[model samples]
Target: MAGEPAVTPVPTDDELVVVPLRHWWRWVGGAVILVLLGLLGWALADAKIDYAAVPGFFTHDIMLRGLVNTVVLAVVAQAGAIVLGVVIALMRRSANPVARWFAAGYVWLFRGLPVLLQILLWFNLALVFEDISFFGIWEEKTNVLVTAFVAALLGLGLNESAYMAEIVRAGLNSVDHGQVEAAKAIGMTPATALRRVVLPQAMRVIIPPTGNNFINMLKGTSMASVIGFLELIHAANNIASRNLQIMETLLAAAAWYMVVVSVASVGQHYLERYYGKGVAR
Candidate 1:
């Protein structure tokens, strides 16, 4: 027994104590109650209530256009946010103290402010400047759509960049200092080392959270409606008010939103899985 491994006898299956379902009857009874409640709801809402006006309302030009606008706004805003977020993330991690400070401050201020207030402030920014000229292109007017869309994009993108900076920074920091040192040991510059060694590894952490943020930004695009951007919710509100089928129209908007978010969720899940392969490091 001096160096021998200890051996233990395996127990029989019968020795295991398995708890039976004492609440089986409770579950059955609850299921029955739920079925009855559903039946009652169907009889009242689906059977008797009329939804004849819904198709007519939904098919209207305004609602269709509004839905289109919502899609466009979400896409554009997300694109801007992603690009700006990466830029901010890079700047925050820069070697210069001034660059780091300015990037950090931008993220802090925007993240701290309410998005609605940010949108409103942007819509009114034209009042202060009169006109914004970019590369000799002067904005002809400070119109509601232009102002509101710009404001919403800036507000959401800037706010999102702050949060993204933290995510990106975390991803970048997740990389081992040894990798950077190793790269330099092989004659790589800091920038080249980051590009070839650090960023690829950091992406495992960076991508999943950024996808979630993009989904959130898609939903947040609705805030643009406040400044007269005729997005889905705004259109639904208008349709419901004029026709008095408020519940139905609101429900329709909710349905569309649910569909969009659900699809985004599926995509996010797959992306997470794809990016997660490197996480064991």
Candidate 2:
């Protein structure tokens, strides 16, 4: 008895094993999806659609340039929107009444306006703030020209900021209040507590929605074409007009958009997963 080691007893079959119940709808759904996919593939490969024209889609200079411009617009606008959103979110959350009011007003004003009207407004904004003068002594023309590119950037970025502000504020608020208290207990300043404690924890909740916004912004960039900002859709329109292959050109643009969105989705998946780790911690 002194030399013997203790051993735990194993559970019986009823205690150890658990079985799932069968669901008939899952099988039906799988079969339906497979049948639909088969039909789709067959229809696409049929001679009615000219899949051959796809290769020529990128050969034209207009489409290429439009794609480049779209990429540049999306990247620049999203970056600017994200930075502005963070500042606005912080202001919205600030204890200072003035900061809170200004932030709230900004979000309300921008979010209330339609994006198209906003684009047109910024495009024609030069009519109002055309001149800059500190006093009556000296004056210079303001540099906010509503060029096609500038109009699209300002419209998209500013509009995006309002939405991003809400997203960021939601994320910030989702962080545990106790963490802030703990940070303060350790003598961390408000700014330091936010940066070191709140924001990092908040990112997990922030990333997924932010990714959805980015994807929407990518699509929104196409709206820039209305103001003569030659992004992918506009490029396709130009090429379609010139070549008379309207369907093909538009289809090509659609394909490209899908591809870009798909890639963004993949990136978002990884980002959510990465931040998911932090949330777990």
Candidate 3:
């Protein structure tokens, strides 16, 4: 075998000529979308809208007051919701049956009802109870105590708490049980373990949805107008009623909402990035 000459290896010019895939349909779809957008723009431009009124009402004192009210209500309600949610989340995970059942019922009742209906119910709570009494020492008529702002706060905060509870529960559940066990092994109390080991990590899961919920809360404040709480929409309605420039006033309100939502979105992005450190996006 050694005496046989090795046959010379022959090389062939066989190489793959990679061709990029052509998505002609994507270009066609894009063109169709552009055309539709152009048509929409043309229609809006041709409409009988008082462009001047939009800017005029944007800086109006009434609108400004409503904007402030909307912001305050959203911030306060969301803060309260977060606190209540954390409590409910913990309750749902408690060893005690009463706590768990109560938490479950709370979530079921609030989450099942529409937020608008809750707002209405809070506003009209006098029908259910004539007055709220504190050990007969202090008594106030339900109608008097539950003013428009108070009703809105109670409604939004309570309703949002149900949703926030679920969000929190999910975040807490996402954490590995081993981590909690490890914390317990290290002489950490349950509270300390939750605080130090669990929540900080859970935040990565919690923040995105919570931020979205906050933004939705801002928009949800508009529903407060139904009870005459004078939020942005209510203010716009008032001005439009007198001036007969409904479209313009509403558009101005829409612009303010867009501005606020845009700012909140930017903040959410940074917050997510902060919490998402060392995690693959």
Candidate 4:
């Protein structure tokens, strides 16, 4: 009995069976979501609205002009913002106390104020100052110089610069301090190092948020309507008022906004991918 081998019971195929887990709740949740979407779609379809008018107004000459104005304003304002943002960002990082304080105050003031108020103030700048003078060489009436478009641009651009300054500063900060040191070690000037060594690396971090900001700026151009800049929303409002078809006109404008935003989003995706290359995901 002491020398006998111990018997080991081997598991049969049936004993090793695996029962797959059932996610019944997931199925139920998905069905519920589908049902809700269907209900919403049906309600929208049954609503009494002039669907035909949307198409006609979608491509109206006024709408097209407004679209152009919106695109132009957004592009130009963003360009100005990027330039100002870089300068302010550099100022924020400057060793000079005055530059740092000025940059901080600029960010705080603009970011604190409501952008609409800024726009209105710019539009009505004539109330505060009659004319703008340049070193006793050139002068112009405030009202003459600050047209509706100029007011909108300044308001949007300057306000955006406050945000972009922070963004650029963050991007600049993302670069390793050693990179700047290395550039200096190679006898590069501060400006040259920033342009040649630092900015290239910072761009990888900067491009994504900058793209989002541009899209936001595009939509934000709607706010310019209050100052009579004749952007997409204002153009739509005019048409709506004349025809007494408010919803249809507004919907058409919304469609155009969607189209533009979609195109911009695609572009942004490619730009991001381009810059994101060489970085591990």
Which candidate leads in TM-score?
4
Per-residue lDDT tens digits for candidate 4, residues 103-160, read 9999999889988899999999999999999998999999999998999999999999
Scanning candidate 3 in windows of ten residues, the lowest lDDT window is 9-18
Against the true structure, candidate 2 reaches a TM-score of 0.84
Q: Which pairs of residues collide in model 4?
A: none
What global local distance difference test value does model 3 have?
0.95
How far is 89's C-alpha from truth in model 4 (Å)? Answer: 0.3
Model 4, CA-based lDDT: 0.93
Best by lDDT: 3
| Predictions in order: lDDT | 0.79, 0.89, 0.95, 0.93
The TM-score that candidate 3 achieves is 0.92
Write the number of the candidate with greater lDDT, choosing between 1 and 2: 2
Q: Which stretches of candidate 3 lie over 4 Å from their true place?
A: 1-20
Cα shift from native, residue 182, model 4 (Å): 1.9
Report the number of clashing residue pairs per model: 0, 0, 0, 0
Worst 10 residues of 1 by lDDT: 137-146
What is the C-alpha lDDT profile of model 2 across 157-200, one tens digit per residue? 99999999999999999998999999999999998999999988
The residue-level lDDT of candidate 1 at 147 comes to 64
Q: Write the per-residue lDDT of candidate 1 for residues 1-281, one digit (tens) a residue.
A: 78998888787898878887698889999999999999998876865334666666566787788777777777777777667767788888888999999888988898899988888888787677765566776555555444666787877777787787788888998999998999999999988998899988888888888878877877887898888878878888888788777877866777667767888889888877776766644
